[model samples]
Target chain A: MRTSKTTRATKAFEKALATRPTGRCVLRLYVAGATDRSRQALLRVRKLCETELNGEYELEVIDVYQQPILARNGQIIATPTLVREYPRPMRRFIGNLSRTAGLIVGLDLETKGKGAV
Target chain B: MKNNGPQSATPTARLPKCPTGIRGLDEITSGGLPRGRPTLVCGGAGCGKTLFAVEFLVRGAVQFGEPGVFMSFEETDAELKSNVASLGFDLAGLVRRNKIVLDHVHIERSEIQETGEYDLEGLFVRLNHAIDSIGARRVVLDTLEALFAGLPNEAILRAELRRLFRWLKDKGVTAVITAERGREQLTRHGLEEYVSDCVIVLDHRVNDQIATRHLRVVKYRGALHGTNEFPFLIGEEGLSVLPITSLGLNHKVSNARISTGIPRLDAMLGGRGFFRGSSILLTGTPGTGKTSVAAYFAQAAARRGDRVLFFSFEESPNQIIRNMRSIGLRLEPLVQRGCLRFHAARPTLCGLEMHLATMFREIAAFQPAVVIVDPITSLLAAGADFETKGMVTRLIDFLKGGQVTSLFTSLTQSGHALQQSEIAMSSLMDSWLLLQDFDGNGERNRVLYVLKARGMAHSNQVREFLISNRGIDLVDAYIGPSGVLTGASRVAQAAREKAETLTSQQEAARRKRELERKRATLEQQIAGMRSEYKTEEAELRRTDEQVGTRTRVLTAERTELARLRQADAIRAASRTPGKPKPKSKR
Candidate 1:
């Protein structure tokens, strides 16, 4: 399930105190309509999440059409809006979920600049 | 005095209300389509019927933060979402947040069996559910005509639409109902005849082979709205209606003057310049240097660190800059410095109202000290004559209220020699410059003249000008015997005069030489006469000498012999002979 930014951030802080895990993250994709573009984005994001954050992450997909209340809750304006809910300091990206490198950087997944992944 | 006796009773004063968010649409309606009442949006096919209703909902939600609901009779939720995506409105997001609800009411005309009695209660229930679920303050019905296709009974369909509009009012939601325009009636099935609060008609017409979309507010009870048809635009930015009406006489005015950047031209306009916030019309035929003059004004304003918004209807920013370069107007640097903004678009792309709204939005965003519309006449082609005039007047009034200096260029027919006749906005303009091409001596010359300037003295004389690589330059007008020679005629006349003067000087020198020769001949003859007289005297002297010599020779021998013999005899008797001869003579 997609959690609010503040709640997810608070949970991350609590987890940091409870257990010093090596790496963990939570990602959510907020899309307006389920067009071919949004479908492609969902598929690509799912694959990336499974491969990258295999055991220590949660991925949730929210379609604004089916769930418009969530869109306003997120203050989303454009379609395929992705919000990085976890890891203290929330961030969001608007557009198709392409550009893996940019997404990784945006999510703070890589530890170092070049070889962290 | 008697009217003040019953002052004790006072009615509750009604507070001024905000419009139902359509941008400039609110200002035209004075406040907006009466609050919480049904305002019908009717148009023909593909004339933005659905989009207009949707935009009213979207703008209300996003701009005003008011919750809205959209009831579509034709399209599904998915179709509406994607269609509005290009306009940057995420309708689905509004839906997800419960701020907006999109009800896709499916109606199959072939399947529905119309009994003796038919009502829109099903649609009303769905509408009420959507509106209450979101607490929507605004609602839109895509097209009421769609129900006619299903229900054959015209009387029932019309009655049902009337009931639906009344229901919306009772629910206290400001609703916009879209309907198809009919060929025989203002609305399909004469729906406009039944609607009470307000009726707006959307039209898409082709005139002179150009397609133009227009919106007219037919009736708005208890509210004042522009009664003229307004041109509208639908694009990535959504639907913008241009309300062509003045904002009335409450605008602020300033006496400050701003330069148009052409020094001589500015000098012509009251030695200072035009009023700071006034609207100036630069009208002329093609190639009369309208764009150059506007660019020069924009660049000048930018140089003073004041922001300038330049709207070009004909040329792109690059083309305008490149062309201005010929006249020494460098706008790229100013644009780079963020002092100047260049917006270029085709006038036919949007309706007059949309263009004006876009202009107002840009002005609000940029907050420029000056705004320039390269050619305002291009917009006139999009509407009827009266409509065009109203739109321009309203635009000028709005600009004046905001204290933004507006410059507009208009293209007139060549050789007409008349002021801008398409729209009667000349009197409304604070300053007017007339540019024309005068055909004289078989050559066309571009000339600029100030027609009128209110509250300022301007040059009335027409000045000759040239559009060269360096920019526009005011050349002194050539006054010839026939009339004024401008452009090529003046240049040719100057050359011809030089040639004539040289030939005349040569001819006069030839005459002088002939006179000098005749005088010399007369002088020589007089000198010859003196010589001849001397010769005659010399001959006379020589003849006299010869005569004297002959006489002396002839008389010398006889006279000497007689005198010698007489002297010898008379010598002795001379003493005695003198006394005897004297006595004898006595």
Candidate 2:
């Protein structure tokens, strides 16, 4: 089931890479330390941006253990939190990137109905 | 007992405390909250939970010299600073001095999405950073329950909270975690399950339409704390938990005496007055001069240069001043001199606890040597009977603790048993003066007598409490066939007795004069009788002399005839017999 879901996500990412970017996406990933979850979240977010947005995004990774002021400024309470600072209304995604569907919907990368993305 | 050893008896076995420096709170907690452990502070809305948390941090930083970190999930940095500024806590100054660090952690659920399991590692890192920056020894997470609302998963949030509390403990920072009070639980999100070292519950209850805030230590692991709910107040200074009953009867007693302003009343009270640092209960019916007696006491104390704080629940300060002026008591000068202060408020202005808190605040601020509560019974209108009694007990205890002489005037109902009704508080008083109205001669007059004066040989005689324009004068009430005659009846009784004495004196004088006149008339009659007897006796003497002369002549003639006849022998014998008879007569 996990493999099939990944394949489906990859196919959507390929379809999104075929179109030009409509708007720039500003993302900030806040993590506590160099933990397994932080690494997984960073990799997942980087891969998603590279594939879905096709380099139409600016991603900043912040380690709360080192740069806690940024985390505090961003109102980060949960570890491995993904904050979308641009594309108009701001949104945050909490937890590791084990589930990509919620993140897609939060980042406005959902290609279900709206065609603006 | 767990057989902890001899140290347990020496206080070394008890939990080390981190003093919050809040007034009366340290007394209730037996020092303060458990040191270096997470304490859960739960309360309902507007119950001063945030203030408690803020005060804990501010006091920890400013007073105890231990830096603190305040991570508020609800209010921002500026908001928290301004909110606590009214309490006189300079949060900004503390932050600038590196004694405190204010970090606001806001989480809006509407702008967030949760996909999977996550921990509160970000919060821990932020707290760690803030604490490390200032080397803070105390941490406060005010209203940490906001996380439950912000996060989507409760199980994970609860797990993370457990870990966070443990982490706080490992960090060796005394942490205060405030949460919302829940129905049938200590906290809304069951935060008490974690942070179980100590749990404090703040309650704001409205009794008889008056709101009062109370604090109770619900749970304290391995530490002793006051379990009873203590009334607390959020005043200009800060939160003060009143552990009034805990004051006990251990206050120092003073042998010094203060006058009651009325000379005769002082004479009645053992030729001096009430003892310094003693609680005096003055109970009377309405219009029976209770307030007058209290005012006199206040004036007396003020005259002696002792500050007097008058708590008038029945009348305003101006009204009291005006009324007292009618009795020739000039309190305006004492008030102006700052020796006498009047705090007047209606009984229904607040709850008994609030009233008590206000009184405590006033007493603390004024630092008066004498306190007068005019008509303390008015406070009963704002609370239950037992509650009022408790409040009075606490007030007396507090006053006694400060060595402040207190006089409490209680207004009793006209027909209720005075002593019986006052029995609730009478035991707590060191001296009790009962002012009553004697109804006779178609008028009611005030009478005062000391019902009980502990450790003093007080007068037992009832005194007529006269409130004239000259002031209170305690005159000896007329005690006669009518009990305790006062007012016009006493004067009338005195006048009647005087008139009776005068009439009896006049009757005695008139009878003596009549007796003297009768004796003089009798003496004159006796003198006249004596003169008549003297004249009769003189006439009898003259007749006897004439008879003797006639007898002498007859004898001479008989002797001449006998000699001529020459009968010498028989005549001589007769003459001898006559001579013997004459000699016998002589």
Candidate 3:
């Protein structure tokens, strides 16, 4: 069942890549204090990137505790802040990664049913 | 709530004004009272009429180095000094230094007779002489009511009082004439209606058992003054009026965010912490660790190279720092580095508005990123509920607009669970941390719950916390069959469990005793039955032996008789008579 799904997903990915192959996006997540929510947000963001952007996107995870100055400079007030630094407009979304749809829209990603290519 | 006059530019001329030198009072009256103008201060008894007049003259002479004259109709200089000694004002020192001249004018009302119309020329000479002796610029008449009493008719006395005020005004000297307030008018004889350059009304009223001293500028000509009833506190430092309504709004603001100390707390407040210019209210009951939380936030901000100011109304600065140290918060280093400042003053030192003004002035000078007012409720004792609420609202607005992260602590009364004051201040705050004493499982536990934080995602669950030598630590909330335990109920539950265990032990002992008694009774009965059976057996054995012996002896005698004499007769009779007697009897 897993092999069948991968093959089917590869087919769809190839079809989409064939149409729009140059528009790649990079995402970075800023988190303060290693809490369960932070870990969940990280995992969710990674999983969503893998499923949606696949290998075309670059992701960087910044732990604010290890870099307090960066957190201050970025004006990050809460933990699990996801920032689309590489993308245009440089939008930032703060929350647990549970809200995948909201993050997708906030990061300016193409939705599954609308605005593809 | 009413504005007294049209907004007009104050004529900054030589209108004799005496500087009260009482912090906000001087600022509110536009450089004190018309320098040498005789201004009447009328109020009821114990309404700080005497203290207000005394502080005006004493502060002018002592603080401003202006010589003053104080003439009293009620108390002597010694009595006045003793009364104000607790407030740290040295009235006698000023008198000895030739800066103050005190005169007690003793007048008997019955001895005076108004034979002819006369002005207060003698009183004027005495005042002028006292002023000349010390080169005085300020004069305080403790009670003009005594002078009124000395005159026979009210009509003549009222005219003379007006002339006296005019005379002092012409002398180019600032005079404070105190008069007892009448039930209907501003003064006992309506003297304020006559001389109307400036009329200040002092009121002492008890609302819901709280005594508050308020001063209202009834009329101040050529000066823009606050027309509201300003709360004033009379202490060792004389009279300090709390001016809450007069502050400029054009202050500089910063857009930076500051840390709240606890990393998790900071995370909840949007990884960076609170907005640089925001007021946070940490409200809870006693022993809920509100002070500890505030100290943690201050220390955190100070560590990050940001200045922090802490104003405590309950504890002294030393006591607050010492208590924080015991709870693992070190503020001494921050103080040494000039990044942290701790100011502690009694809430009763001044009225609520004055306390707010003092804090505003201090914060303005220090320009701290974070400021903490631990327990703002204690300072509200000097004003009414409406005044306190207004002051807090204005303070929140001021702090927020200044871009300073302000934290306030409030003690919630038992029955008043709803956060009425905090609710009023909620919209002005960027973050709200609600600390509470949760009673659960018969134990009182201190729990902190974030009610709301604008522009940041925060934990909604209430977390149990402990304050120790290291600092504040967030512990997991107790989850059990019973809810959280707190206060006296927790102790009573433990005692009850202990009593139950003791009762169970006693019950077991009682059962063991009952069983032992039953066993002993059974043993005694068994022993008695064994002895009776043994006796019966012995008796039975003896009877059997006797029967056997009789049988043997009879058999032997029968044998002998049978052999000796016709033998057959005894033997046959012994043997056959048994069968024959049976047949014959039948």
Candidate 4:
């Protein structure tokens, strides 16, 4: 069932890439340092943007160790946090970006919500 | 409370402390929270946990010259600043001076979602940046437990917190982590498990409908701390932990003396008055002139140019002044001159601790040399017996510490137990004067006596306490066959003695007159006898001269008769008979 879901998601992702939504999704991922967890979160968030945001989203990664002032301005508490900046109501997803499905739902990128992908 | 073994056995093994610069708190923690280690301060809602944390940071920055970082998870920077501004902490000014850094960690439960695994590295980074930006040596995570509600996955949160405390310790910055109190643990999230260097608990308890805030040091590692709970107040200055037991008997004493306004009373008190800075307990029954006596002392102190602070529990200041006026004590002038101040309040207006805190504040502000609490027993209605006693102890200790003479007037029930109510507080007093109302002589009378004077020679005699228009007077109560006489009885006794003395004086005058008359009559009788003796002497002289003249005439007549007889021998014999007759006449 998981394999079938992934294939279907891939086809929709292609369609989204071709259509290229007008409102570019702005994303920022805040992490502590160049750790394994931060790397995994970075890779996962990038993949999510490419898949769900149709390669039209702007993604930026912030290492809190280097730019701590930015982290404080962003009110980041937990490391490996993904912030949806362009969204009207800014949302924050804490923890390493290992649960892609929840992140997709949380970021409101469920393919226009055909019953939550 | 836990004692962490032999770590505090030696001075070298003890943990270096960071002085909090909080009143009574440093004395409780011996110095302060352990240096370079996180101290967990947990308390229930509205127990002053956040205030305590903020004060710690502010004091560190302002007083200790060590900059601090305040990372509040509950209140924003503006909110926290405004909240502590009431306590006179200029947080904004401190922040502008780079002595403090405020980081309000906004955490909302609805805004944050946990996916899988995470750590609080962002928080750690922000804290580090804020600290390094200001060179902060102190850090505060005020109510950090808000993170638990804002984020999911408690397991990760716990592990991250443990790491965060370790990081803070390793950073060599003293940190205070405030948390919500738990039902079964020290904190709601058991944060005590992470920050174990020291744990302080703040409590807001309402006992007998009186709410009081208490602070306790539950555990201290490698340091000795006062383990008992202490009453603390979030006053205008800041959070002050009133460690009542922290006051020792080592306060310097003054050998100076002050009067009680009433000269006779002063004479009774070792012919001087109460010792300077001495705590005096003036206990009496209702209408026994306790307040009057206290007013006298206050007036005396004010007259001597010593500032007097009067605490009236049973009457208003104006009322006290007016009542004292009836006894010729004019407090208005002293008040106008700024030598006397009156703080009047109802005992039931607040809790005992609040009352104590207010008294302390007044004492500190006024800096009075003499303090008078009129009818202190009314405070018994505010708390339990032991609590009242403790409050009095703290008050007296605070006063004596400043070398301020204090007078406490207590009202007692009119019975044999009049001397028993204030026994608990009498031990803390340097002198105790007992005033009683005697019901005799068809009227009630006030009598005062010194019950105890620790280091002075005080009169043990009771005196009649008379409150005339001239003021309070301590006259010798007539102690005679009947009993201690006062009021009208004393007057009547005095009058009777005066009458007796008059009668004796009149009798002495009458005896002196009688003796003088008898002496005059005897002298007259002796003069009359002398006159009679003089008359008899004159008559004797006349008779003797007449007899001599008759003898001479008889001798001449005998010569004529001898010549006429012309007889020879017989005439000689007749002349011899006539000569014998003349001899007989001689």
Kindly give the stretch of ten consecutive residues in candidate 3 chain B with the minimal lDDT sum.
B110-119
Model 1 regions more than 4 Å off? A1-117, B1-18, B109-125, B151-166, B190-194, B244-249, B346-364, B377-387, B412-414, B419-423, B436-447, B466-586
DockQ-wise, the better of 1 and 3 is 1
Per-residue lDDT tens digits for candidate 1, residues B339-374, read 999888898876666677777778878988899998
* lDDT (tens digit, per residue) of candidate 2 on A82-104: 88888757898888888887788
Candidate 3, TM-score vs. the true structure? Answer: 0.54
Q: How far is candidate 2 from the true structure (C-alpha RMSD, Å)?
A: 9.6
Candidate 2 lDDT, tens digit per residue, B16-42? 999998888888888898899999999
DockQ (CA atoms), all models: 0.01, 0.58, 0.00, 0.62
lDDT of 4 at B340: 98
Candidate 2 Cα outliers beyond 4 Å, as residue runs: A1-23, A112-117, B1-4, B7-12, B417-421, B482-484, B514-586
**Of 3 and 4, which scores higher on TM-score?**
4
Q: Which ten residues in a row have the lowest lDDT in candidate 1 chain B?
A: B8-17
lDDT of each: 0.75, 0.87, 0.73, 0.87
Measured against the true structure, the TM-scores of the candidates, in listed sequence, are 0.61, 0.85, 0.54, 0.88
DockQ (C-alpha) of model 1? 0.01
Best by DockQ: 4
Tens digits of per-residue lDDT, candidate 4, B276-323, equal 999999988888898998998999999999999999999999999999
